[model samples]
Target chain A: MDDATLVALARSGDGDAFGQLVTRYRRAAFLVALSVIGRPEDAEDAAQEAFLVALERLDDCRRPSRFGGWLMTIVRNRSNNLVRREALRATEQIPFSARSSTPTPEKEAQLSELRDEIARALGELPEVQRQIVLLHDLEGWKHREIAQRLGLPAGTVRSHLHYARKSLRKLLKPGE
Target chain B: MVDNGSIPLELLDPGNSDPGHWARFQARVMALAGPELARRRATRPLTVGEVLASWWRLLVPASVVAAAAMASLLMPAETTPGAGIAIEEALVAGVDDEPLPAVLVADQVDEVAFLVAIEGGG
Candidate 1:
């Protein structure tokens, strides 16, 4: 079923529909939280909190069809709030895990290097650019979908994506 | 379509949120959701500040009306014929202005007598 239909059902107290919606958006929500909070456990907490909040305020959603973006906004807000509240305690780290017990040497080396450089670059990005980059590159969200979710124009999403990728490429250059 | 493939998709998805993790997360969320949903259904309790704010609205108008009533009760009586005359004004005001008309002379005497009775009583 479409998001609008599921959202409507959820608003009428359908727990199953809400569950389905949560399943569909949980990954995107996690990525959004991770982008802001920079820890897997904290990101999970923020994402779960966002879902709970979304469920409670489902009726306040003005556009149900854009539920993914709406949920992402909540995730981002919650994540940012968590970060602000724990700013002194938050240790800077890659947004995702880098360690793997077993992997080929070359692939592991590449992953290690990428994790370090990318984390620093991503941390340096403006929140909007980081969000657009993560949604587009990490989550495979299309520009139009991202635009709708972020309430930005498609052209702006594309422009931000281009600039973000360019910045990442420069920052991730070898031997820097 | 920006293809920087350093990060693997397998690392980001399909495995990070394993079924067990998803199940637990879902359960936790649903559990918290129960109270949140109930709280939304419940009426919000008003804070003391809010109660006082509402009372202030009613109190302001009621106080205004009460003050106006008190002021009216305490206002010196207008010195009209029907209104009770000011004692000082009756005793000394306009004493030399004119002689009373024949029809009003008796009434004037009665008013003067009443005023004298009040003064004596006081």
Candidate 2:
């Protein structure tokens, strides 16, 4: 079913419908938060909190059909708030010991390293470029869809995606 | 899509390699939001019928009071006993410009006295 139908069902107390929405948008929310916050752990927290916030304020959502964009706004706001709070706390970086406790399998460790490298590279890009690149490349969203959701022109979205990919390639392979 | 040859863009996707992670994430969000969702549902706007159904007990009596009030207002006012006589006496006195009768001055006019005063005045 479409977002509007799911939103209406969820509003009527259908837990399963809401669960489906969470399942569908969880990654998008997380990626959006990650793009803003720059930390996987903080991004996850922001995304989860955004979902709860969205659930509480579901009635205030004026357009149910554009639930994804609405939820993204919440995620972005929550992530920005987290950033501000973190700034107030003066915490600079996640302590290495705090990232993981148990040793990971070799393959998982390599994948984690690659993920961190990609995150660092993406961090070097402008915020809009990071968002566009992640949504287009990682989330598989079309440029037009991203434009509509972000309220940018489709050509601008495409241009950002192109520059973002170029920058990512350069950052990932400085040796080459 | 611009071809970023061997960019490993898929590696950046959390869901690509670890679907279970996202599943757990979804579950966690649902678990945390369960109460809020229930609250939203509980506080959902009442339909007109539901509102009437819920408040029918109070509403029914209130409606009765309102309707009785409206009926009373719409109906011609009822004159109290002797009120018409007092008004008629006042009108007669008013026409003659005689000293106004004491019944008109006093709070409660003695109906018999008032009739005698009216006869005497006439």
lDDT of each: 0.74, 0.79
Model 2's CAPRI class?
Answer: incorrect
lDDT, candidate 1, B1-122, per-residue tens: 11453533334442353558777777888777776555544555566998999999999999999999999999978655756778757776768744334324674557666666668656
RMSD of each: 18.6, 16.7
Residue-level lDDT of model 1, residues A53-98, one tens digit each, is 8988888899999899889889989998888778656665334343
Residues B1-122, candidate 2: write the lDDT tens digits: 11345566566555676678888888898889788778767977878998788799788999999999999899977756765657667668746566556656787668888788789879
DockQ, all candidates in order: 0.09, 0.22
The estimated TM-scores of all candidates read 0.60, 0.68
Clashing pairs in 2: none
User: Where does model 2 exceed 4 Å of error?
Assistant: A91-102, A174-176, B1-4, B45-122
